[model samples]
Target chain A: MKAYLKKYGIRLLIVVFLVVGILAVGRSVRDGGAGLLSNVSGAIRTPFQKVATAVVSRMEELYGYVYKYDNLVQENERLRAQLADLENQIRANDQAMEENARLRELLNLQQKHTDYTFESAKVVSWNASNWDSSFTISKGSDSGLEKGDSVVTEYGVLVGTITEVGTSWSTVETVVDLDTNIGVLVGNEQVSGILEGDYTLMRSQYMKLSFVAETGQIITGDIVITSGAGGAYPQGLILGTVSSVHTEAAGQVEYAVVEPFTKLDELTQIFVIKDYQVVE
Target chain B: MFADVIDFKKLRLALVYILCLAVMMFFQDTVFARLGLFGVKMLFIPAACVAVSLFEGGFRGGLFGLLAGLLCDLSFPESTFLFTLLFPAIGFISGLAAEFWISHSFTAYMATAGFALLVTALCQMVRVIIVEPGSALTCLLTALVQTLWSLPMAAVSYTVIKRISRWGNKR
Candidate 1:
């Protein structure tokens, strides 16, 4: 028995591993849920990821400053001149009109949604896979986050939805992830449609708004926002502007490409909406 | 004398390899994740696996492949079965091929590494292809670009592992 074990042990182990791999693949495809291995590894790696992200971010900032020093000097001089001109224009337009309007808008939004609960999280690491657009955040269920919670920018632009949460870290599937689907209203007509990530569009950091009626009047540069129909996402969260409109080959279907307001690549901090009253 | 009997050189080599793998994982997860060309990210782990396997032989290669595969799966947002299954197979086959037919040369390593990379790229897109048939062409193009972009990682792996292997030989 000992001799037999020595002879075929490698083969037996290979079989076992293949079985495990197959099962894992099946589970991943079936539900897209994290397994025990994922949870344990995530718990172990979260701290390291946080440190690495911080170090890399600092290094990038330093590198940018060093590399762009000369360019920045020249640009700074140009910008100073431009700033003086803009300041003159601003004084001429006077009443502090732009600042007043911005403050009023902020006040209106604050007064309108008095029930929003915000929890801030820093992005620790991006998903290493080329196939998906998601990132891990430093906050998780420990911070009162849950799967399906909406994430947004500080200015109330929709970023994504939390899909997987570990004890201390959560994965945010961004607005451009292939699996993300959100109901959106477009243009002044408020034409309703389902906005989803498309494989081709995602590479360009864009999403597709489909199911619009053939008669729907969504043109280029139209504002798109969350419809808040099903209470899944908050109403009036800025999605993006329409980049271009497209029609199906048969002309029976229409879709518009939306360039999201919050650039996914530039995000460092995000706010998760822990709870919100359904605004309809 | 005790160290020689226990082959301390091998032990030291293993430790160094582990350290190297960890550093590579760190860079792959953080630095490489942010830097991409034409929307294709570099895959360092697989290239490192192939490099180590070619020098270390089948048994060790397979083991390292398994560890690297697990890390790759864990690190990605959408975990796939492809890396866990394919990586070890690539390691084992590359090891055997190196032992029997191929020389430990840059050209040979690149050829084998390219094959491993192409397989990974194709396998990654199989689900996307099945679910979104219309996007098949775009996925294929992306996969090709990823494979091309990842070749420099293979070159780096070769240089690093070659130096390590030479040190082991000298000792």
Candidate 2:
């Protein structure tokens, strides 16, 4: 045994060093820098990470070009069909202009919780791991992006939450991760439930809205929004639209399938809601 | 003169291996990060290691694999040193296969790449099974996509490494 150890001691040492490196990183993520090794590693890899993200951004631009062209082609076909409805619809809408304005006045947001200050970030890379839905954003602790800060779209739709932070980079775990569970409110009924990401539903780009009372009747296409009950997220941020609802065989518990408002896959740039007032 | 020749050869090998690892990491992290073609993230570095192992030796490939693993662990918090162990083993196996059966031909590239990609897909499958068993079906599809995407990259790596080796031999 001693002879074998002596022969392969260096190799064993390297392996130990590597395992130690990962543990340190896992520990340091909550606090920012892992130790000497993780810090050094993150620093050395920073430039490469930046370049990797930049390449993706450029590719997204190219993809957007192709996507837009495809959309144009599809739009042309749809327009050919919809041309008959367009003039009639426009005339109908023009007549309802006063009613539309009245509805807008009623639905106009007053920003009851206006304490939100945001930091814009460019998605630098995605989690290559198949097990989770996450990505790295360019801004980090330097931008006041703390772990648990909310991430969102330009339209203030909830995307994910920051889970890990470094000096210049932070990882955002999307709402579709099985580990994510947030208190949510649904529809005009004010139905309350725990919105959670499930491993199975993730493939379909959906999440589970569970833990509702049997008294609450949820219909298809009902909008889900953050309830702000746990103070983890601000209230009224759009989560998703109800796709399906399910009831247990015992009928004691119920859950609704939610499809996110934003296409998580197509998001290249997002905003970090660094600070927000917790509404009770 | 003999000692100098050996030293130069070792230096060349190290340089080539390091360069391949760096470039592969760059492409995988930056380019492949966002371009999820067909729901699979392209793993281009493994192909580089397989190419070098075929063109040079197993030890060089294993070393490159080690760095590649380290790069993954350091960059992505979710990835652990299990990657470090896996990549080296893959490198060793690819190198061994290259030493025994491969030549500087398209067939060799295909064989090496197919084997390497198979191993990578296996790891991903295991990841889905062990870590997130619920995602197995979707992960399988992703693994297939990743393997297909990596095939062409492996061919490119084989061609590039072959040229690099030719230069090293002349020098």
Candidate 3:
């Protein structure tokens, strides 16, 4: 047994060491030995660490100064951008106020012509997803809003029709949706067209003047308005501007891309045309 | 040659272990990230501890493992306090085995390797229980894989330490 033990003594010693080492290391790690080591090492190496730290810090300060200079330059650029944006917003607001004054005058003119009642509604929220481009208004069923009610801005410009009615909220599906189709006429020219939405392109829809003869005198920038032919909307409501005019190869039809005057995203306030009795 | 009379073998072994621990701690993250196989990282410190234990006596070997593990935990970013306690416990257990039970044969080396693997796996299991109680499946799988992977390294370290110890005895 002694001879066998002698032969294996070294191996046995190693096994003993392995177990002890794991325990010591584990204990030290648990009890914040690292912080203690760092403190000790720091005390021993302070002069060198400090000198190195100072040199590095100075270099960092120089780099920081450079960064600050660049930051100031960027800040100046940002301020200039904000100034330009503010100027644009101010110009837009002024134009809107002037348009409002003009619309008020038009409202008075409209009152002389039609006995329709109007209720003002403020746009509160928009659908967050593109799958539904509908917007909600603060006025709803309580505000005499019902499905199929014609919605327009203060200037008698048709925006959309109220599709869904709730107690305190209503949804307006703009004419740009695929499901919407309104009979329209070119202002004063009396040229009739069927305004239908194109779902493929989200932004704009097609206003096809299918029966307009090829020789029909349609020009660019012509104003399109609701024809009041289908009794869905009041007559003479502004629709959009004629952006393009194309004659079919067969020479019997003409179509135009009418860019709406009012951006759908920017719509804030609108009126419901309440007293227009449907001619059904 | 006369300077060898002071028997700097123990000191040299201690220094080597210290150096190895430092290197392992410093590069632990890089090593672990690069060398993970089947989602298991090799526990290099435990293998080193086993090696040191087999080469040096139990006390020094266990001390080396404890220091190595402590250094590793210190260097790690998301380290917890439990590592310090657990690692040293593993070292003590392994070192006790090395001191009392190890034999000088091929079978002895294999036994040492198996013991080292078991010690490491046990430490890791305890850590998992404390840190993530419900993930027993993941903990067991990782611990098993790491233990297996550590075996070869333990063998190599054990061999190297044995050679050095023999060289020390010759002087």
What TM-score fits each model? 0.72, 0.67, 0.39
Error of 3 at A126 (Å): 1.3
Ranking by DockQ: 1, 2, 3
Models, CA RMSD each: 35.3, 35.6, 35.7
Residue-by-residue lDDT tens digits, candidate 2, A1-280: 9889887997899999999888776776757636776689999999999999999999999899888998989999899879968988988788578445533432342243467777778887777755568889999899888999998876678999999999999999999886789998888998889888776787567898889856777878999999998799988888889999887798654788999999998886777877888876
True contacts kept of each: 0.69, 0.29, 0.00
Ranking by TM-score: 1, 2, 3
How does candidate 2 fare on TM-score? 0.67
Model 2: residues with Cα > 4 Å off, grouped in runs: A1-111, A127-131, A247-254, B1-9, B101-105, B130-132
- TM for chain B in all models? 0.92, 0.86, 0.74
Total clashing pairs for each candidate: 0, 1, 37
How many angstroms is residue A3 displaced in model 2 relative to the true structure, after the best TM-score fit? 99
lDDT of predicted model 1: 0.86
**Local error of candidate 2 at residue A218 (angstroms):** 1.8
lDDT of 3 by residue, B1-171 (tens): 868776577667557667666765544444543465653556656666666666565676668767866765543322345456656655666567767876656466666666666665665466435644554565566567777876666666667667766765566
Q: After superposition, how far is residue A70 of candidate 2 from its true place, in Å?
A: 45
Superior candidate under lDDT, 1 versus 2: 1
Report model 3's interface C-alpha RMSD after superposition on the true interface residues: 22.6
Writing each residue's lDDT as its tens digit, candidate 1 over A1-280 gives: 9889877997899999998998778797869887677789999999999999999999999999999998999999999999999999889677357445544654565576778887878888888778889999999999999999998876788989999999899999999888878998999999889999888888889999989866677789999999998999999899999999887787654778999997898887778889999975
lDDT of model 1, residue A88: 93
